[model samples]
Structure formats: C-alpha cells, structure tokens
Target: MTSLTIIDLSNNRFSGPIPPNIGESIPNFLYSLLSNQITGIIPKSIGYMSHLEILDLSRNSLIGSIPSFISNYSYLYFLTLEKNNLSKTIPKSFG
Candidate 1:
C-alpha cells in the first residue's frame, strides 16, 4: 500500500473526509477524486506528499480554506480544486 500511486476514484458516491493521512499513506502518486460526495476540509497532511505530480479533488463538498501547504508539491504540474468550498487566497508559495 505504501508504494501505491495514481489513485482515481472519480464519478462515484464516496462520502467522507478524505482518509486523514492520505499524504503519508501514499507518499508518491497522482491522486484524483473528482465529482464525488466527499465532504469536509482538505487535509493539511497532503503537504507531505513531495512526489505528487497531479491532483484533482474538484466538484466535491470539500469546505474550509484551502490548505496553504498545497504549494509544497515542487514537482506538481497539474492540480484542480475547483467547484469546492475552498476559500482564502492561494498561498504565495504557489507561485
């Protein structure tokens, strides 16, 4: 499970906060959970995934300010958090 990568659970009815330690659970991956029934705030722990390249958590019921740590993905090329309940401007480090 630790070596896992590329999780795509889109277009499902999965409801719940994303697994609390998903960042540490899958340290290197392209994660996507689009268009689901997921709710709650995006976890700050996702910042620990230094190897993440692509992440899409859009169109869910996610709430709260987008974690400022999202900018930690140095190798991330694509990311999408749209259609969610995120607020607070993106971190300047996102640049």
Candidate 2:
C-alpha cells in the first residue's frame, strides 16, 4: 500500500525477521512492532522509508548494531528499541 501511513503490529507475539524490503513495499510514516517475538537484525532497506516518522520495535529479540543510516531520516521524530537483544552503542548521529 503506497498510501499507507501506519503499520502497528504491537504485542502480536509474532516471530521472525522484518521483511527486508518493507520500505520499498509500504514506505509508511509510522511502524510499530512492539512486544513481539521478532528476531534478527533490522533491515537496512528500512532506511528507504523517506516519510518515516515513528518506529517502535521494543520488547523483541532483535540483534546487531543499529544501522547508522537511521540518522538520515529527517522526518523521524520518535524511535524506541528497548527491551530487545540489540548490541553495540547507538550511532552517534542518531537523535
């Protein structure tokens, strides 16, 4: 859905990695995958979401360092990755 603005799948207990091409598929403004069983790294293609404003992936099983490209989102205002297994320090340029 090119016109979609939000995708909230919070607390759904879903597992698995985020789709690698989600940004090219939906490019929504808000995306929430909170409180799930999701695993794996955040896809790099998510950086292609030009209109993205909010992203929440809390309480999941994600790993790897946060992508540095996330700081390029000029429209992003809210982001949360708490309670997950992500490692490494947040990118210095991130807000």
Candidate 3:
C-alpha cells in the first residue's frame, strides 16, 4: 500500500493474514483485495510477488489452506477465492 499500485481494499475492516512484511514496503507494487473483513492464511510471502498479476480474494473472512506457495505464481492470471471462510484441500496444485 506504499504509494499504491492498484490496491483496492475491498469492503473494508481489513484484518490479519497478509503481512510477511508486505514486500518490505512496496518493492514494486500490485494488489486488489476484494470484499474485506479478511481473516487469516495465504501469505507465504505471496510467492515474492514477481510482478503479481491480478489476485482477487473474493468475499472475505479468510480461514486457512490455499497457500501451496500459490503454485509459485507463474505470472498468475486471475485468482479469486470465491466466497471465503476457506475450508481446505485445494492444493494438489489446485487439482
């Protein structure tokens, strides 16, 4: 969120689980948080955001399990966590 590069703090009341120093203060930025009230998990340094391409955390209250280091983001296209409260078992390279 430093100087901004597409950060849309979705609904608001942003909670935890997205820290990991957050690219050490915007080392080149990119973000789009969708529908907030964000809870936990999904921050393994966000695979070091290699010029991240569109990650929309759809409707939030995020629980755990979704971070297989985000498949190491091969220039992620569009990842939307449809209706949160994340349960688990999605990571076999996301089936």
Candidate 4:
C-alpha cells in the first residue's frame, strides 16, 4: 500500500506493543517482525521512519527500553533486537 517496500511478519503468535502509529501507518516500509510473539514497548513512533531500511525485532517476548527514537533511522541498514526480554540499558543511541 502506497508503494510499500517490504513487511514480513515473521513466525506467528504476535502479541502486544509495536503499534504506536507505526511511522504513520507504514511510511516507507522495510519492517520485519522477526520470530513473533511480540510483547510490550517498542513504540516511540519508530522515529517517524525516515525511509527505514531493515528493522527486525528478533526472537520475541519483547520488553522495555531501546527507544531513543530508534536513533532516527538515518536510513538504517539493519537493526535487530536480538533474543528479546529487553532490560534498561542499551539506548545511548546504540553507541
């Protein structure tokens, strides 16, 4: 839709979070929800997607922290939040 790029909802059993308008409802796609069963927190509007490249929420059961507006994308090449159940740290714009 609207000339979408790619959206792969990986490995079913999707849960909550991951919806905060999703960059105004899929703006310049390339989002893959890897290994589904998504949990809470991961919003922050996805930094308004400045033409995202690849964002994979790896190995689900997501938790909080990791949202520095996703470092504003900067045309992200690939960002995977590995093996979920995230904690506090890991946000200094991912250094």
Name the candidate that leads on lDDT.
2
Q: Quote the positional error of residue 15 for candidate 3 in Å.
A: 13
Once fitted onto the true fold, the runs of candidate 3 whose alpha carbons sit more than 4 angstroms away are: 1-5, 14-29, 38-59, 62-73, 77-84
Model 2 per-residue lDDT tens digits across residues 1-95: 77789899998989999999877788799999999999999999999998899999999999998889889999999999998888868899876
RMSD each, Å: 1.3, 0.9, 10.7, 10.4
Mark the regions of model 4 whose C-alpha exceeds 4 Å error after superposition. 1-7, 14-29, 38-59, 62-73, 77-84
**What global local distance difference test value does model 2 have?**
0.91
Model 4 agreement with the true structure over 1-95: per-residue lDDT tens digits: 66888888898778877887887778775888999888887887777878888899999988877877677667887889999988857667554
Q: Which ten residues in a row have the lowest lDDT in candidate 2?
A: 86-95
The TM-score between candidate 2 and the true structure equals 0.95
What are the per-residue Cα lDDT tens digits for candidate 3 across 1-95? 54566776777868767776675565434476788777786666666776776788888777877878666666777788988877756767642
**Number of clashing pairs per prediction, in order:** 0, 0, 0, 0
Alpha-carbon deviation at 2 in model 2, angstroms:
1.5
**Per-residue lDDT of model 1, residues 1-83, tens digit only:** 77687789999889999878877767766989999989998887788888889989999989998788788778889989999
Q: Which model is ahead, 1 or 2, in terms of TM-score? A: 2
TM-score attained by model 1: 0.91
Better of 3 and 4 by lDDT: 4
TM-score of candidate 3 against the unseen true structure: 0.29
Output the better candidate (3/4) by TM-score.
4
Local distance difference test, each candidate = 0.86, 0.91, 0.71, 0.81
